[model samples]
Target: MYLLKRRVLQFFTMILLGMLLLVLLYSIDGLIPFLIVIAIAAPLIVGWQILFDQVQPQAKLAWLLAVLFIPFLGALAWVMFGRTPRRHRRVKRTSSEIRMFRQAIEMERIETANAVSDRFPLTRTLQKLGATGADGHTSTKLLVNGEAKFEAVLRDIEQATHHIHVQYYLFRTDDISSKIRDALIKKSNENVTVRFLYDGLGSQEIGEDFIEPLRESRVHVEAFDPVVHPLLVFNANFRNHQKLIVIDGKIAYTGGLNVGDEYLGKEEKLGFWRDTHLRVEGPLVRELQRLFIENWLYAGIEDDKETWDLFANEEHLPEYFIDEPKDSNGATQLLVTSPGKDVTIRDGLMQLMMEAKESIWITTPYLIPPPELLALLEVAGKSGIDVRIVVPGKGDEWFSFHATEYYFEQLLKRNVRIYKYNRHFIHAKTVLIDGKIALVGTANLDFRSMYLNHEMTIAQFETSSVQELHDAFLKDFDESILIDWSILRKKTNGKRFVEAFCHIFSPLL
Candidate 1:
């Protein structure tokens, strides 16, 4: 009854706003010249605001030019949708009970990396970028493909004794995912607390029929930032793209793989899906679980929780919340970037580029990079750093691929070698720097992952982990076809026009 009433209230509220906008426009029907003036002046004003804002000069110019040219997407829609905006902002905040739980379990996000291994001068710049630094003791393993990763993850879920916290951006209702769901349901039947949080937009295909079985088995199933009303879901940019699975607060799994048959290479259209994931043991699960807890809180959004919290407070904080970090099995740290946060993954990646001495190897499915990142890559390449990048040979997204190609000529001029993986889609989001630090997780090197979405990137200073990624990158290099600047620069007029056209909207994407 409460949920229905709240949803009804939300629906009417949106209706009222729509009617108000309609009435406002209706009232101005006779004022055609004035409206036309507003159409022009409004864009100019917003474009100016975008220019003077903290954004980079190149990006500001790009957006400014976009606004000046793109006729339909005027100032109104630009501010409403094009900005690094979020639709999930409202749902994540309403659940005050979860908020209280988060407060109770919150711990100081400390740098747990040991100084003896992670030397001060070497990691100084990284610390300034808000990295928790490296710990040599925390053990990590590199899981190459989806089958191996999910197999290990399912085993862990089955072995979970006390509680399990699982979160993913894409939770499909396919073969691999069904197995996962059944395992979770089985665990829930065993009276183990199983909390599953999935992105509302990413898992939109799974209806109540698919989820009811889990709910019936006492599994705590929730959707993150669900679209309460279609009218409110203007932009699906701020999706929770982080894949986290923590069991009993000790072990966790994260990486590029989502729950789908496609991820397991069963889908013929995408062919062999090549990706990377990590199996984390030791204290790093604490941090990974923290990410899950916070999102879980956000997913459990409720309106009445604000008043309910003051009197019905019963905190079930984890034991690790108050415990101090000591030497763990292996050393690892997380680079978490979410919407509405001061820290960003961009700053950290830039710092790493600035600090690189030898080489920087990158693998991403999407290549639409922000100007700052593009400039940094160029600078890194020109500075005698072996900056090599690998992107998909066939783009899953048309506009994004063209937008990626638009930046290729500049990068090639700087001697930054770019490769296109010819065989299969390389979905690994990883950065190997100087053979010293390796970063792996879900955050892509695109506008959406860099600024708009919730992302998790774990960095390992452990020698073996770094070596594993380096070796994998070298193997991928074997199959990739290198780009020839001479051939690519001579694209036909129509192709060039489309590429440039796509580049205009790349920032918003």
Candidate 2:
């Protein structure tokens, strides 16, 4: 196959480059300096492996052997293979704060649950999902696309009374983004607290000068995991992909919609972007508000009493769910996972897939799942449960698109029905199991999202929500092209090989 040949060629090329560089260094006549550099680098590489071995044993073995055999070449290999500490540090901070915040909310949830259990008789799954208690005052609205979601966002901002907290993966400086920026500025001038958080890497296309006007208006603006520093540039691999907006701690919006021309379908190249977002009102908004506060604090912004008061509930009772270290409620578990964290969201997803009984429905833009996850899906399909996945027919990233196709041959053989959206790019990340539970969030079923990015997903236990998700899945199915195994088999060998080569670097991609 061409992909296999490419990997073989790439492997040899790397070897040749490494040997040439080493030979050149050896000829420099300054053997002592070269040896000294190796001496310093070897231990650092070893130490990093030792730390990683505790969590990722496979990575540790790969790195440790490389460093032990060729100290100089191994050092380079280690940098490529090793986990990034800068990202690890941010993960540590965020995870710790989220755990603490979840603990603080436990008691309130228990009280709310006890009161609501008599009425709703919360399902075991819902109880496990930490949704045992229900708050009557809260409302939820599902927005189908970016246009609807952004329109709602504008409406919410216009009505902002005390504070507005907005965070997104991509916040462009285009017309749509400008409209929201203008609203934030107007609110700031009206003495309303306004803060905006955008991913540094995701918003790289937009210049800082574009945001200067909002800054001049006294609206707090910060970039999450900025790559401005030389040493931190590699940290760009791990991004804050969560799109959240909290208004006065009473309303919130979250989902796949990012502030960009592509998302709004304003970009001529990519027309009519399809996505999903949810506008949440009631007690759940408090949790969303707390999430924003954690990010705000991470950005070195202070949370004042006035801002804290917005989170304090005096009228509407909120049912809170605490994220326990161990899975307590079988019905639903709030799994928050990040790199260097104990329970990863990807691991949770894997567990969910493995546990599937009757059916599994998934929607994601990218579909570069790990080997283990791919195996799980194949095994699940073999067991006769209806397994289906919806992915974008056309994507923003061509490499990722080709990479996703590499698995189709294997998946089709196992009887998994893969659907490609024909209308537009499907950016929604959601999974539904047996029409009983669903996960909705920014995380995609890709390696970057699973192992590298800081992602968020909400596990929904409510049957109504699960049904809604299922209905949406069915509707999307109607709009998608069912990929046939025969079709994949008929692809040109060159194209197939290209897909396979792209698949090879999927772990790093």
Candidate 2 Cα misplacement greater than 4 A, ranges = 1-51, 54-138, 229-232, 301-335, 342-344, 347-355, 463-467
Candidate 2 residue-wise lDDT at 221: 81
lDDT of residue 9 for candidate 1: 50
- What is the lDDT of every predicted structure here? 0.74, 0.68
Q: Give per-residue CA lDDT, model 1, range 1-509, as digits (tens).
A: 01223334544654575466556666877775666676578778888777666544555676777677753254544554445444345554545555565565445344544563455354445556666554445578889989889999999998988788889888889888889999999999998888889987677677888899998998878888776543355445467889999887778899989889988878786788889999887656666766777677566645423232331235434432323344533347777887644345778888878888999999998888877888899999998999999998776567777888787787899989999888768889999989877889998888778876888888876446788899999999998988887669679989999989988777665
- Cand. 2 TM to true fold: 0.78
**Can you write out model 2's per-residue Cα lDDT over 103-181, one digit (the tens) per residue?**
5555544234443345434333344443323343444666778788888999989998878899987787888888889
Candidate 2 lDDT score relative to the true structure = 0.68
Mark the regions of model 1 whose C-alpha exceeds 4 Å error after superposition. Answer: 1-80, 84-124, 228-232, 303-330
| Model 1: worst 10 consecutive residues (lDDT sum) | 304-313
